[model samples]
Target: MKRRNLLIAVILLGAAVIFYRAFGTPDQLATGAAMVNVTVPELSETANEGEAAFNRLCASCHGRNAAGQDGVAPPLIHKIYEPGHHGDASFLLAARNGVRAHHWPFGNMPPVEGITDPEIAEIVVYVRELQRANGIY
Candidate 1:
């Protein structure tokens, strides 16, 4: 019984240390955004086209301003622009393949099939613009 108890304690201690390393301290969470690195290009006509596409397809669930719909989608402004938000690569992957909760909280963003690669690129530009406008940049 003594040996078993010691083993359990050791395991628990190891798990706690691992969790702390992975999650870091509360201070890390508060100031983490400052450590993020993103390279955002200036909005171009491509971004405008993306905005139009969003209005036609994503507006219903994501909202005209990308503020996110209650019980449907999440706001795209603050979360995406904040330095700690996500790297552009993650955003690109999520948009192209439809991510789960890494980006939005509406479950899965089904792969926007019917659209061309250029269109998807445009949409990404528009989303980035929205993020910037919302103070994410």
Candidate 2:
């Protein structure tokens, strides 16, 4: 009975090792989580249309220059357009689902509900272009 129990424990331990190797450790998991939040740049084709759409929809508060509205809104340029807040995926999520400054305290950004997905994609393009023009990256 003792030998059998030891064998079972060894098998379980081996299985655990295999699982960890396949899935990674908690630290690796955390790193992946952090990576998941990283904002990627936008693709090239839609950049122009995005700029136009932005001018049409988001410019009033975000500004024609994306520099902020003094009392109304925050700048969507430079650091604010960095990974966490202005990444492509983050942009898509914000446009699609709407955001309220989950990562910042500047102020809550109201949802843009009437716009469609294609429009949001174009906005993403424009934002990427704006960031590049601003030399953010």
Candidate 3:
């Protein structure tokens, strides 16, 4: 009887593993945890203005320093977002028009309202500088 129960337990465990592997994020993102450790560098005057704008507009979801909030958003400092792949234009477009979820499990990002074109541009600069500081470039 004990052997039979053990075998059943093993089967259940295997099924759980498969389910998680198929639909789960293997990192801390699900809990809204910070996904990466970021090192901030001194910013240019534009970047500094961008940082303030980011804090006001983007920080609620993107997290402080753009480290990313698990289950909320992906870090801009990640390699997938390096300028070559995502580019400056992508960021600009995303702020103006919401972006669909393509590279991440965080779902779609809606268009950010009440922010101007110039502020969004500055935010991009801040994000790029942060990415550079973190060795993502």
Candidate 4:
């Protein structure tokens, strides 16, 4: 009888663990809910050229304000891409060479074609300004 009870308890504990992993913890659920909705503020054109370049090149996937398209790409306004975490050089590298998607489930980011280094710099400036305005900095 004691052995049967212990087995039942272990099975119950295992089921609970599996359920949590599949459904996620409360905090994970909350975070997911939060990410589902995001507010993108109006961009202050600190770098007009950059803004133009971003609109011409990156707006489709990243959104006009860099708020990011759901399932397509992650938002740049998020803290994950803050300057401390992903610097200006990271943007250049991403433009020059495709980046492996490590942060989001959107898969790999293909390298942008036909954009000059100077243009990329300008886009970086624009993105950084947006990040700052949105308090991601």
Candidate 5:
């Protein structure tokens, strides 16, 4: 009986999460503008390299400094991307495998091609620094 109750509780919790995700607040569903203002910070060597790579690979969609493009992609500097929520590994996975749209209405992200794991790591560093500088961390 205890196990059954625990399972029911878990199921309810999962349903609530799904409901919230599907019907998030207006801010989370915001579109057609830069979601947040981002503060730039000093970059380490690796981060600098990553910045260049990001410009080459991701900026067109994600926007300059990853502030996000309207009707394109969500900002990396937002609270949803803080390390506690979507951690570094999530970025790696997204870059490699893409992700379904849950937070925004921009639809799914396609897997980024021709980027190596090391480059993605550097990009994560660059983004993390940006997040920290902007108080998202």
Candidate 6:
């Protein structure tokens, strides 16, 4: 009987491992935790202004420092957005004209309103600076 019980315990442990692997461990299942802290690098005066503009105009979807928000927008600091792939003009065009959904699951990006070309330039500066700081450049 003791041997049978030990066998049963082993089977149960195996099942638990399988379950954890399939559904993730307890910590991985915790989605309600506070937002993870992300360190944003300091910027030059122009880039700082751009940061403020980004926080006001872009952070809702792009997330602070353009780190990106899941199901909202793709991160600007990612390798896919390297200048060679997505040049500075791409950002301007995206803000001026909404972009079709292609890379990410987050639907199409709508043209930004209430911001001008100069402001967009500032935002680009801020984004590029952040990207550089994070080694995305």
- lDDT leader: 3
Question: Could you give candidate 3's per-residue lDDT for residues 37-128 as a string of tens digits?
Answer: 98999999999999999999998898999989987898888999999998999988998999999998788999999989999999999999
TM-score, structure 1 vs. true: 0.56
Off by over 4 Å in 2: 1-45, 102-106
Off by over 4 Å in 3: 1-29
Cα error of candidate 6 at position 57, Å: 0.7
Worst 10 residues of 4 by lDDT: 29-38
Candidate 4 regions off by >4 Å? Answer: 1-46
Top-scoring candidate (TM-score) = 3
Estimate candidate 3's RMSD in Å.
Answer: 5.5
RMSD of 1: 8.6
Give the alpha-carbon lDDT of every model. Answer: 0.64, 0.65, 0.90, 0.78, 0.89, 0.80
**Residue 67 Cα positional deviation in candidate 2, in Å, after optimal superposition:** 1.9
Worst 10 residues of 5 by lDDT: 26-35
The sequence of per-residue lDDT tens digits that candidate 1 reaches over residues 20-61 is 866767754432122223234466788878878877766666
lDDT of 4 by residue, 67-135 (tens): 777556777778998999999999999989989989886779999988889999998888787777777
Model 2 C-alpha lDDT per residue in residues 1-137, reported as the tens digit of each score: 99999999999999999998666666543221111112335536686677677777777767655665544555677676765655678777776676776544335777776777788878876666666665666
Off by over 4 Å in 5: 1-33
lDDT of 5 at 62: 91
Give candidate 1 misplaced runs (Cα > 4 Å): 1-44, 80-84, 102-105
Q: Judged by lDDT against the true structure, how good is candidate 6?
A: 0.80
How far in Å is the alpha carbon of 21 misplaced in model 4? 13
lDDT of 3: 0.90
